[model samples]
Target: MEKETTRIEAFSDGVFAIAITLLVLELHVPLIEETGGGNSLLKKLVAQWPSFLAFCLSFFSIFIMWVNHHKIFKQIYRRNTPLMFANGLILFLATCVSYPTALLSSYYHTASAHVAVAIYTALFVCINLAFNLLWWIASQDRQLLRPEITDEGIKRIKRNYLYGIPVHTLAFILSFVAPTAALFLCVALWIYWAYTSGKLDLKSK
Candidate 1:
């Protein structure tokens, strides 16, 4: 019999879709007809700077999560119930990130922004933890993982999670004391991820 698709995979896809869509909703339609000029339209958009910032961060965060999830799933041949559930938790946490991101953009430079950033970073760390748990279970079971993948490759994957969690945790804490610095650190982290993803051994299978 063909193996049934797991709940986790389906739920993750749904959650990611929702999260990305929610981000765009933050953008308001410009009342350009009232202003009646291209310059006015541009100025209206510029005034909603918070929405633009939210859109950028939300888009990047959703895309990164999707890319990372895709890479992890590509190596798996099948999924068990527990694996599916673990992935669901990760997706749930990921979904929560959008709200905080929106809040951060709207209330940035205020105490609310600190809370929002902290929540966003916490969601990220939780998702990573869930991924770590899912990976550990799959690696321990062996059957779920691709046969040709090396222990070293798996270790490297785990290492990525290890590093990501702490960095995010630190950023979360720092947001209260220095939100701007924390944000800059996160941007730097993403740049590092861009470089590292290029270096990952795609031939690990």
Candidate 2:
């Protein structure tokens, strides 16, 4: 079981690395004025707010997903077929998130921006769903969880995941009317996770 889990971890890590690389491909050189020198080029690039915003959003979103995946596997000492599929599903959803995030950033002021946000939120929802499924499947047989894990720890993790998905999804939904405000809320939640997960009490063995 350990060997199988290790293989899954390795394969997933490779996929994640590839996904992160692909996300950056969306950023490109902004068109600069022909006569205006270095200052013009810099100003043009800075004016391309969409590219920077998309890059930041996608990078952080993927990073957080990777962190959560690491946390889940840390708690699971073994693996089974269901866990394998669940991990695959999570990766699949994660790969889809970048495109929508980029799309939303590009079309942020347009009428179709809402659709992009919806797609982005939906992909994250799918990711969280797969996460929950993997946790339940692995815990059902006790084949994946560490033997010493407490029930309360399991409950806390589940609660954290459950609470997070809705907040994230709703933030995306609300981007239609108040995109800047929604984006700020999303950033706040990301900060919360970063700080909370770093706590000694939240660390898993």
Candidate 3:
């Protein structure tokens, strides 16, 4: 237990860092030839808005997850095979976020925008599901959590996961008919998660 949780956290941090870093690959400046000339530089830069927007959205999503991951570690003090595997599920989906970000940037203005947004929302659906599983497994036994975490703290965490799934699923459903709305919901969900997770800090309870 001494080095167990610490090692898991360190490894999880690395995965999150890599995923966040990969998101930047989807963003690039307009090349000299592509800009046509210095006079047209602003126009070309403006055209890359989709990439810029998607990068920010994806960056913040991963950043918030990283923050909440730290918050979760503050409660979890033990590790088991199931818990580690559940956490790994989260890391896997997080690493894959860059792919959908790339998809959205490439297809945001095309007829395929709905498909791209659906894929992005779908990834989020899986992410929220993985989080729920991780929390559920860790909270099932006090042996896995810190001495300070109470039953209410566990409930709060569970409540957060419960809210996450249906909302993300709704966004996923909306993607087919309203990609822009679905995209907007993703932004809102991150903000909601940040707020809820901040208040649900288990160590404090």
Q: Which of the numbered candidates is closest to the native, going by highest TM-score? A: 3
RMSD of each: 3.0, 2.6, 1.4
> Mind sharing the TM-score for model 2?
0.86
Count of residue pairs whose backbone atoms collide, per candidate: 0, 0, 0
Quick one: ranking by lDDT, best first? 3, 1, 2
Superposition error at 42 for model 1 (Å)? 4.3
Against the unseen true structure, what C-alpha lDDT does each candidate score?
Answer: 0.73, 0.73, 0.89
Q: After superposition, how far is residue 170 of candidate 3 from its true place, in Å?
A: 0.5
Tens-place lDDT per residue, model 3, 1-205, is 4535999999999999999999998888888878788669999878888899899999999999998888888889899999999999999999999999999999998999999999999999999899889989998878988877778888888887788788989999999999999989988989998888776665554
User: In candidate 1, where is summed lDDT lowest over 10 consecutive residues?
Assistant: 1-10
| Model 3 whole-model lDDT (C-alpha atoms) | 0.89
Count backbone clashes in candidate 1. 0
If scored against the real structure, what TM-score would every candidate get? 0.84, 0.86, 0.95
List, residue by residue over 119-159, the lDDT tens digit for candidate 1.
76777667768878877877777678776778888788778
Considering only N, C-alpha and C atoms within 3 Å, which residue pairs clash in candidate 1? none
Error of 2 at 67 (Å): 1.4
| Candidate 2, poorest ten consecutive residues by summed lDDT | 196-205
